[model samples]
Target: MARIKPQALLQQSKKKKGPTRISVTTIILCNLVVVLIVFFLFSTYRHWSQRSRFQTDNQFSASEDGNAFMDAKKADVPGYAVLNTSKGFVTVELFKESSPEVVDEFIDLCQKGHFKGVLFNRVIKHYVIQAGTAQGLGATEDWTLRGKHYNQLDMSLNLKHEAFMLGTSKGKRNDKGFELFITTAPIPNLNEQLIVFGQVVKGEEVVQEIEEVDTDENYRPKSSIGIINVSLRQKI
Candidate 1:
């Protein structure tokens, strides 16, 4: 038998090591694949969970009993609008006919509890505290308000901007419902140009408190004016 040289023995060892290296690479690849799968599953599950929470049912019902008040035409006019803010309550009377689509969209959002926990995102001193726009990532989930179309009406109406007069939102027309502001001072420029649908009937003190909050250079409140709840009060 011929004795193997040290060099030959080393060469054999390298060949044996090749299979071990391949096995290690395969294990690493498998682990990476599993990690990717897990990440994808987690992301998909989270997306679906959020969607279910914000999903809205657009079904509107009218009373069958001979109560004409519940009819869609009558129901479109909200009896009263109230905003329970962290500072206090701000109430308004809805002007249904002046801006029917805008007012109805607002009422529907309130009924769905969409405004609860939202904040007044913008506040301008002696101007307004614009709330109803969703804060953070919550607003993107349900952007459609039952496919309502946006329309701009002529601002020739004889309405004055009062403390709580709810005006049309300041974005594109028909984008009125989710964004609302309560006037801190009378903005005459807005007269008739923006739909003045409602006026604050009560809680002027709360509105004053919100207007008095400390704000930053950009006029954003250092502390948020959070909406605790919003509901309708029976018309007197």
Candidate 2:
């Protein structure tokens, strides 16, 4: 029992003890904060990555003719359609940039044998040849990939209806259906009045041959010329 002053006792009482042990609550709270932070960062990164990846896609430049086109440097998603007809096989280049959903629907239909044995119901000499029923009357039963004209893009990109152009038949303004057509000559009257989604890159002579086929007053080919089959593939 050494004599100690009250001030000394107070100082000793104020001395540091052993290190404080972290409680379970503190540990859990710290871990939860770390997890939340990681989750936020991860979500942000995924969003940025997706946006960056598709930013260049579906972009286009306006041409002098008011036609929309993806720059030459930018890669094009062109589809090559090899139409096997009674006359002959014709190759076409469908531009996805002009009409994305329409082109996709067309490709889907072709893959599912949509046009197999389908007649070119309407054929006009030196003008155009047409197929697919109005409003796609008999094209149902898994044939409709989407709603009727749900992806309506009329005269998309102001695509000109030039010679050998492929387009959808219109019943009314912006009311086009599966009825497709190919021009044997430049149908300037139909320019901006129809959606020009594709062009015959090769076998123009074949299309011309079909145009010259025998047709009645209603422009229906008398000899029953139509598509035997249609094959599609990727192009540059």
Candidate 3:
């Protein structure tokens, strides 16, 4: 019987050890790659969640009723407007106590027939029903009363964007004051910049009806919605 050489036995051991070492290294590398991928995915998800939360905080969010500031007893006594729309009439109670100047301007405009023929050109479902543009989209006749860009009045009180709340936007364009909108749902995010001068006291059903109207990409109602007339009345 021939005896195996010590060197041959050593060589056989080296060969087996080589494959085992390679297998171990490969497994380690694969595990490292998996860890990196998981970390990357976690980082991406965290970034997206933070961005989404910030947008939610800044953009439209439903809030409580606009009447929270009004005293129950005096709620019935606030001066109100009767907005006769193509759909129907919607009565709005103005917040004269908190926003005196803004309310005065709005009332004065109504009395002067500034909004009589104006149409609610822009309408968004569950958002707002915008109108008061002099010639609808772009005729350059906005801010008819001042004939200039409307000033941003201070928001006198903390008011919620409840359904039927009347609001106005502030910006550099001449149409700032001319464009008015009614909230179909609470928009807490708009509480800071937009003005809330009134709340619908009657015919809120009419406002909801307007929200149901079909609109274009620009939120302009496909079918016209004109303000047949608007009138102001002192609280009795």
- Give the candidate number with the greatest lDDT: 3
Per-model C-alpha RMSD: 25.8, 17.2, 21.3
Error of 1 at 142 (Å): 28
TM-score of every candidate: 0.54, 0.53, 0.54
Query: How far out, in Å, is residue 196 in model 2?
Result: 0.9
Question: What lDDT does candidate 2 reach at residue 168?
Answer: 78
Q: Candidate 3 regions off by >4 Å?
A: 1-78, 134-160, 171-177
Q: How good is model 3 by TM-score?
A: 0.54
lDDT over C-alpha atoms for residue 141 of model 1 = 23
Model 2: residues with Cα > 4 Å off, grouped in runs: 1-78, 135-160, 171-177
Q: How many backbone overlaps does candidate 1 show?
A: 2
lDDT of 2 at 140: 34
What is the lDDT, from 0 to 100, of the residue 174 in candidate 2?
Answer: 24
**lDDT on C-alpha atoms for all candidate structures:** 0.67, 0.68, 0.70
Q: Residue 139 in candidate 3 has what lDDT? A: 41
Ranked candidates (TM-score, high to low): 1, 3, 2
